[model samples]
Target: MAALIEMREIVKIYPNGVVANDGVNFSVDRGEIHALVGENGAGKSTLMKILYGMERPTGGEILLDGQPVHFHSSNDAIAAGVGMVHQNFMLVPSFTVAENIVLGQEPLRNGLLDQAEALRVTRELSQQYGLRVEPEAVVDSINVGMRQRVEILKTLYRGAQVLILDEPTAVLTPQETQELFAAVRKLVDQGKTVIFITHKLREVKEISNRVTVMRSGKVMGVVQTEDATRESLARMMVGRDVFLQVNKPPVTRGKKVLEVHNLSYVSETGRTMLHNVSFNVYGGEVLGIAGVEGNGQTELAETLSGLRPAATGTASVNGKAILNTNPRTVRLSGVAHIPEDRLTNGLALTASIDENLIVDRYFRPPFHRGLFIDYKVVEKQSADLIQEYGIRTPNGKLPVKSLSGGNMQKVIVAREFTSDPALLIAAQPTRGIDVGATEFVRDQLVKQRTDGKAVLLISADLSEVMSLSDRIIVMYEGEITGVFPDAASVSEEELGLYMLGIKRQTKEEMEAVL
Candidate 1:
């Protein structure tokens, strides 16, 4: 059979002289789910963006059904039966699922939108595709998994024959992920093609028919799923053997390092973001918080890190109340924070790598002489960290923006881990980095726990939570729905139900351990 889509010798060069894609060749057959696996800066997203008309390739052409085509914009690609669902959902929160789906092309009767027809069509699509979404449910009121279903349905409703999904399972639980695989198979059975882009190697093995690996803006190889293992795929992507499982020793609980009681946060809009939240994190143990993206995780991280203040609660770091204090005060209290968005909250991109590494320590005696920063000490610290962390950089004096995503993340992790803090707050610490970097970060977190440091880990990736935490807590709608003193007690599927608010532990069960 002829290929459904083919991209030949694709090359993309940015104005800053970054070659995102270099003479790449990729193609997919009809009714096949092709997996694109790569590191953060490996050009998988850029190549797909070019195919979806989000970016124009500097050199190359896309052929659809054996015919060369040019897409000036996303509209052009959509008109040609291609659709993309980004990692972040793009939906109007106030709109219902049906209205959001039919926003661009709604059925009309008597010069008005035909709401009845819209609901009927949505019902039919949901049934036909096995998406299982409620037509009238408002987007804001739905969970992350349901919102993802709405995105898939929207693409199918737009007459998309080739669907491009970027990090579809990044925010889903194990059970929801199984359901999505079922829907993907259904789409393929109906003769549609799917291109799945992800950092997850296991998902590729579970749901894809073929796997393609890319590295440094080039295709390394493509192989049948049956012929690929996580080890093999990872090796292709990163040029070495990578550990898929996190190695951790048994937990030995130590002194209590963090305590929060009746924590409540109200936003500027007078909305209660967190309600009666309470937990304890101890040295030599990592406390993992698992939830969908918007389920008060951000507020909790910010409040605990001194970026936001809780309305009604008391929180202590190392037996001292540090609520509402500035970051410097929190650091002085022997606390370190690895925020969720590395680019935004972790680093100053334009600053030199040396400068970024010493921001928290520049005022110290050794690094600071009188009123001026000691350049010799700064240079030594930067060189030591770069060597110890294995950061791939030409020099410490170069701007941080010159480094790759994984290296930039290493700089943050190295600095935070070396701070000798009693408490560490790591929120999505390895979100978009590669397999190697993720393994390193997880090991570092476990190392801190092993060294008698308290860790609070907040992540959307359920696997990270399960593998690293000594205890697990599930949050939904700003409330603690369940708590497991043992991380191994609940399966990912069981934990996902609580994440979606489908099931909740009794008050007795949650209160005793939490």
Candidate 2:
């Protein structure tokens, strides 16, 4: 089949001397699910932006359907039947689904929007695509998966013949991911071309007809999906052997390092969030908390880490009750926390890397003497931590904001792990990072286990939980549904059943494991 879109020798150079795309040649076949996979900062986004006319390439010629074309802006690209759905959903939270669907191109009657027409069209599209969205429901009221469907529908409503989805499954549950794959297949069956950009090789193998691998702003190769393996793709992208399996050695359970007893928290509106949640983590074991997002996972992590005040409960670190304790006191009590939202809670973006490295330990004796901080000591320690953590930065003096998301996460990991606490609370430690970085982070966590430190790992990724945890606690509706001794013994479907509250375990069954 002829290519629908083709670019020859695409080169994009930023004003900061960053070569986003260098002599890159790419093409997508008509009516096929083509995947683009690479590490972060590998120029996949830049190539897509160039195709969508969000960025103009410094050197290249683009051919669409065998005809040379130039798109000055995204509007031009959209007029040419191209649309992109960003990783972050672009929807007005207060607007209804129908309103968001027909936002920029609302039907008009006598200079006023035709609300009835809009609703009818949205319903028709929803029915045709099996989106199952309520036209009148507010965007904020819907779940993440439904919101993603609305975003896809917005592009379909624009009459796009080609759709670009950037990391569509990043925030979805396993069930939701299957549904999304079904939707993608349906779109392709209806003759819509798709460009899927992701770093996950498994998704590429599952959903894509062909794969294009990029590395350091260049196209490494393109291959048939069936002929390609994750190992092959990793080798092509990183130029090295990649260990696909996590080697978590046997852990020896030691003394209880952290314990949460009868934790209960009520919201400001008198609604219960966590209901008598209790768990224990021993030194040298990773206690994995598994749940669908927003099933009190964030609240549990925050409460245990002393970031949120528990209404009623006791959280102890190394036999010391630390409930309602400030972060400083929690740290002093031998607790280290890797918060979920790295940008908001983990790092001071405006501060220098060196300053962020020592923010949690600056007041201690080695960092500070008497009433003054020792600058030389701080600098030396920060420099060592940066190198030890493998944080990719020019120097520790640079601002944290200048680093990429993965490197910034590394800085947070470095600071928390350097403390060498008795208990480690890792909440979504590898969230939003590339696969390479994720592997590194998981190894570090396993190393912590080897060092006999207790780790409380809260994650939405089922595979990570199954591969890394010694014990799995499934939560549903803010309650522990089931506790399993080995994560490998349980299937994701079984876990999903518990996570969605479709199944429950008896107290006797839970007690046998707990």
Specify the highest-TM-score model's number: 1
lDDT accuracy of residue 235 in candidate 1 = 93
- Candidate 2, RMSD to the unseen true structure: 2.2
For candidate 2, give the lDDT.
0.89
Worst 10 residues of 1 by lDDT: 243-252
**Candidate 2 — worst ten consecutive residues by lDDT sum?**
264-273
Per-residue lDDT of candidate 1, residues 279-349 (tens digit): 99999999999998889999999888888988999999878998888788988899899998888889999
Model 2 off-target regions past 4 Å? 108-115, 266-272
Task: Write model 2 residue lDDT over 1-514, tens digit each, in one string.
Answer: 7699999999999998999999999999999999998877788999999999999999999999989889899998999999999988999999999999999999999999899999999999988877778899999778778889999999999988999999898767778888899988898888999999987788899999999999889999999999999999988877777887899988788998888888987777687889998889999999999887777889888887778889998889878999888888988999899999999889999999999999998998798899999989989998898888889998899999988788999999999998979999999999877777788899999999989999999987878888899999998778999899888889888887787777898988987877
Q: What is the lDDT of every predicted structure here?
A: 0.92, 0.89
Cα misplacement distance, residue 309 of candidate 2 (Å): 2.7
